[model samples]
Target: METQLEDLRQQLDKQCLINQELQRQNKDLEQRLQEKEKLLQELQGQYHELDGPSQRPSNEPEFRKSRAAVISSEPIHETLDIAGTGVKKTVSETSLIVKAIQKNDFLSRLDDEQIAMMVDLLVAFDYSPKDEVIKEGVEGDSMYIVADGELSVTQAGRNLRTLNSGDVFGELAILYNCKRTATVKAMTNVRLWCMERQTYRTIITNKSKKKREQLMGFLKTSRTLKDLNDAQLSKIIDSMDEVKYQDKDVIVREGSEGNTFYIILKGEVLVTKNVNGHQKQIRRMGKGDHFGEQALIREVLRTATCTADGPVTCFSIDKEVFEETIPIEHLELFDDSKVLQETKAPEKSGPSSTLKFKDLLPVLYQEGRHQGDPVTLGVGGFGRVELMTTLVHGKYYAMKRVSKKHIVAKRQEEHMLFEKKILKSIQCDFIVRLHAAFKDTRYIYMVMEFCVGGEIWTKLKEVGRFDEPVAMFCTACVVEAYAYLHKKNIMYRDLKPENLMLDVRGYVKLVDFGFAKEMVRGEKTYSFVGTPEYMAPEIIKNQGHDFAVDFWSLGVLIFELLAGSPPFSSSEPQKIYAKILDGVFKYPPYLSEAAKSIISKLCRPRPGQRLGNTKNGIKDIRHHRWFSSMNWHKLRMCQLDAPTVRLIRKGPCYINFDRFPYDLAKAEEEFSGWDRNF
Candidate 1:
């Protein structure tokens, strides 16, 4: 049996190597194919130019025949000329956009109505020859479609190809929220159509219902997610991220640790591996094929390297969610495996503490809201949460308005800017999505996904603590949310009930990025900015703290959820901070031993000696005896309901919040230069 197992292992290894070699060969073939296509296009253009003054196709319909079918919108007369000389021709601007959208596979998959809606969202532009449309390695959204012009695609100063009329670039970046892979410069003075990332996603979800269904279909067919029902699949699809990759881009490298699983939605990928120090191509993967299963399962090195054969589109899901979607039996098998946790061991606390907020942030500031009074959802000293509506689609959103005067006065601008950046990266379902952000002269506005069930603090206080089962469900969600945050190197400084809000479905959506800090492994901060009772000893003692601080706060949060108040609480702020430092909180006689044990371990006096701060970190907490009877898989899947989630009466249940008007305590005199980019 042993010999057979060894032989099987060797066979698997050999096949993996062969698969890699095949992928390499496939990639080479793909590159060659692209070169030949480029040459062919150049020859065709030369033939047309040299063959006499035979005019190019006059109608947008001529191009649409070979590409996608154009979808017309409601009666509107917006026209654009098909002429290359920048003269007004026959076609309408909407028709030109439809012509361009049809050329891209992802956009082409949308129905006619989606195409029409996309036409409305497009913002047209004109550029001169040699104008850099999109620069390589720069982070941006806004896909550009050439309306009438030629553009050169280059990487590392080498010309890769030329894009003519109806061609699109930056689609992948906009779709995935990733960095641009190549430079696109106008070879001829041209007209183009562009759309922002949010607009594009909105068009798909709000307008193109068919495309959303198609996305669900992709998830349904996935081998790992095949067993999930349609409802579960739909939920998963909402969290899926679309990423675009250019040709020769390494999707995953063999032996490197991975956290995300990829499913090819468009184009092809080459899967390769190394054998005896020689690179080998194994196999080629095309649309609908998924790779990196081991990655989504646990902390494991990729078995094969995958590269984009040409322009590729993929849907990705990180390990945190993947673990919940699949069967528990599957996860149990990998319990003994070695998972490499990425640790960015900085020499110090990392970035400079005193960096100016104005310098650190790229403020996407906007003006003119001369419409309606801000509908206040909740309020505090220096900031307020209000409901804002977009003029274009009329969709409502929760906008967090923070006072610039207060931030500058306290010298907390760096902390504030850092918080926004952390919110923008790598979002998942449990985390509140930062949809759009804007800054003005007086305040900064963060447009975020609105949760309907009010703060957990209100719910907990109304119910006067929770049963063990109810607290367990809420705590599990926090664990998953923090897992995503900690994986991204973000430490949530505050984890009290006030920051935990419930969605309409009762799942917790972690919010308030105000005190969150980016602390990679080996890096720490000594900032003393947290609710007094929830502050970890390290922070209170002026000792540098890291992700462990959040876990410590989690302990206090759990205790509060069960006991109706925090383990260490006092009317006086100093007394509360002192009790937190002493770490001598007691549990009531009615509290279960299991619950008390978790709080004790979590709220340990020594920050490094805390339950979750150990080598295993979150893993230890998940496997603890207190949660032994818990169905963590169900909890993560949101299959289990929070026994304590309040029944919301209104659309958002803002009634549960404090009804009195909030004061502008930070209404201190605004300073110059400081509040300009605020």
Candidate 2:
């Protein structure tokens, strides 16, 4: 009995040892499984990021593609009698009108004279209680300022807000053609001051034309401005403000700190200086004469006092404006020798070398080169971009492989060819460099310099919005690129974060010239192209558009960079178009006055009146107050410090880009013979 009990104890001990070993193995397996699940989740997140709509191609035909061919026409500028019959207003009424105009952002931008003229053109109107002053969806041709009583605003049966006295409504109608966005009904008997669109435009256009003509005439005969071109003079005019002084008013006091350059527009001024404890006349200046020219170059004490001889009118620009609009080097043209040297024609040079398809075909088709399979970088509706390295040269390049069948199906052959042509012809630091173009039976390929820092849109997604300085730097880069392209008569119709790439240095490089077209000055194109949110109102209307459209897109890009979204956006393209056409948008309270001003000027509904498209051209934009601190010279040379440099250096070169899966399906069909030129 003792021997059997001992055997049972030995068996129990052996069973306990086996159970302990099994528990240890099970815990080890669980840990490994948990690790695998974590890895799987991470990979799924990466896959979804790459598969998002952000990377999807946004290019689409305009919703009105089925409409009849659009006829190209010059922008209509209607001329009205500046001295037409006007309604006289009492002193109190005039003061009220001025206050009302000043309260509105759009009207407040107008000058004192313009505001006065607008007030004179306003006609008084009375509305009964509960009467509909403006109906939603009805075409509006006039704008109104509430003089008394209250009005209600509603859209789609929802009360948007209430308009009290001095409120402005339907103001966009006076600026452009658009249907009323919301209905305005009189809650109580309302008195309003209204101005028709034609009348408003006349006051704006005729006033501007007259002022420009007067300034140009004066600037042309001024000896101090002889070295400047018409465009330069125009820019100066834009920066200057009119100042009127009564007879004998002191325009500049002797020994006072001076920083304003003045040009005489009307009347005369007497220059006097205090010499030997008595005032002595130095000179008498008339129209076309200028004073305080040295004040524009540097800070100096006034050497003389200039008093108005009679009722004097002068155009005055501060030193900041003068220096920004006209560079110091350009001002050197004032020297006679420098002017002569600059006017002399330079020796003609040979044509610049461009990438040729024939020369690149040999390198691409070398036998036994041992080139590895290309890694997919990005995938889009048209095709994909792949990372490729040449074994012979050992250089990495981005090979854009566009499927031939896809282009044919979308009828985008012309656009594709044009893009290739543009890429080959341009050589700019801010633009992606295309080294070669070649073709296969299934695809057309463009080999370009690889931008390792990847797309700006990806960075924007990581950070909700950019700080002011970073946004300014990025915008300055685009401005440089646009300046070059616009000089070549090329319009980059597509301007968005997705189309802008950053290099290893974190400098922006504009890519994908699919929608770019070289239109001659004063010419317009009818074809619709561009991302929906960035599309200009003219493009949405199917009206003729030119380089001005690019400036409109630039405004959208600026807003998106600073606000994390475009001002006009919707999931439906039609809604976006409607918003753009309405020409109404609110600025966030955080936006600086300068930022809001530039965006407003750039996104003007009238293309001719746009900041960059005006007679002053891009100078108007470069000298804008928002870029007051920007060193344009440093920005153009890529010497400005980039905000993304530290972030980029810490990660892999291509960290900002998502890895896309390679398409394993065979080409649906082979395209032959048509790509002979490539």
Candidate 3:
């Protein structure tokens, strides 16, 4: 009987333990539900705020006008004084700067010469104990390297960390215009070597500009390359590799297989020929002189031996790169037998006749109007997209209806017009075509080519992530689009899966040009605009950015496609920017070395060093091992099968997109005449 009582007691203990576990799990689930509800409420508030423009301030016209004006109207053009007049540094100070920079991720990418130049530009400043070295929420223009003593970092009255000698601070200031994030107070008497943003920009800009100009001048004077246009010349300049030779060094040996074309930048080269088994000097080539044109045209043995007369620096391009940039017919000009004929430029075609605003007016307002309701394809912060069909032809197009009141309230008038201008100007197969645009008193409308396969973002969400082949194919389509745009001197600032849409054929088409801007070659725009996760370090710093910013975003897109998330992401924009500036992100183990390498090259902190930004332009990216099997020509022509083909439905379907409620209301006040030309 005692044994039976003990068994009952053990059973009772087990039941109590199980009950306790169930209660704990229930509590956890309840907490999670509360958190989810909070998040959902926040999202709904944002949605309403975006969809309903009436809540936005209507009496801030001056502020709205000034907002667009804040963007610099002129490109920054600061020339460095090359007279060797800069801050003089002591040997110890120079060593300190070097050490400090080497330990910094942002500055470590600089080459030895650039580092030396920056070190020469550093000015010394001393701070006393308890003094504020830098304050939070103040725009900073100078970066400092601690030469001695210690400092304390604080943000919002909270102690963050301590800094010692060799530590760097305010580095972003030197890179771009940004408010200091944290306050730094000197804990001891401190000496810092500082560099100003203007000085730093001058050094980088002058160096790059001078080199490009010199190479361009050489190419322009070359008889073999004279037929090439400025754009083609730029490509050649980017592909050329800098080679230096010591005195008496043989640059080319007679009778060796030659396939490289050379242009001398500095020093001299002595051209000699083997005459009667003896090397006899024939001619001397100096700076601006070019040789070996025949080698690029066809495979041939070197006819002459060229030796460096002294220390010589020359730009050399491989035959493959040379041929890729210049057409074979153009290269054939090097041969006397080939006639140099002028090729007539193709006639530029305007927008399609069927896409005229007048033609679409009937469909939108009269006979072809929808009998009941239009299909809401997608919704966005500014407006919504709807599926519109013409009755007579039964052709479908995506009509983007943006609220003018929302645009004005958000101070996006300039952006809206600019987007229309850019869309109308560009014509590429990989880019969605803008068929028509017209605005009413209430909203501005854009008729764009309907993409049936829908946003890559939606597809990615459904599948979680893409395999290597799919990612590569998608990336390739974007590459083609960017190549076209970059060549036209346009920068597509916003690149995300949501902006990338697939057609019925599963080919990717880039949509949305709200942030697109045309920047002249070698010029930088100081616009701090882009998606947080995809923004480059330069863009985050508000430093001047050019086409290079797009490449950085491209890297992020590639990572997101393969890994299912961007390399740097956070719930907060500030955290995302911090991660971008830190330049530390993990690559998934499943990613191939080639994929990682291309991503790394594209995501370099220095804009000038990014893969597509280099002189080789987009060729470096195209030739990357990750895309070794890519048939660029075929892809551009849409001949290659897209990886998303299996996922796409047949003709004019919206299966990939989520349906949104038609919540847009009529404008309370009319916005007249601003969009007359749209």
Rank ordering of all candidates by lDDT, starting from the highest? 3, 2, 1
For residue 369, model 2's alpha carbon misses the true position, in angstroms, by 29
lDDT tens digits, residue span 585-612, model 3? 6877777899999999899776655787
Quantify all predictions' global Cα lDDT against the true fold: 0.66, 0.74, 0.76
Which residue ranges in model 2 land beyond 4 Å of their true spot? 1-374, 649-651
Q: List candidate 1 segments past 4 Å from native.
A: 1-374, 391-394, 644-646, 650-653, 662-678
Backbone clash pairs in model 2 (N, Cα, C under 3 Å; residues 3+ apart or in different chains), count: 0
Kindly indicate the candidate among 1 and 2 with the higher lDDT: 2
Writing each residue's lDDT as its tens digit, candidate 1 over 226-266 gives 76555345434433566899999999998888999777878
Global CA lDDT computed for model 2? 0.74
- In TM-score terms, candidate 1 sits at 0.45
Query: For model 3, where is the 10-residue window of minimal lDDT?
Result: 61-70
Local error of candidate 3 at 58, Å? 53
Q: How many backbone clashes does candidate 3 have?
A: 2
Provide the lowest-lDDT 10-residue window in model 1: 60-69
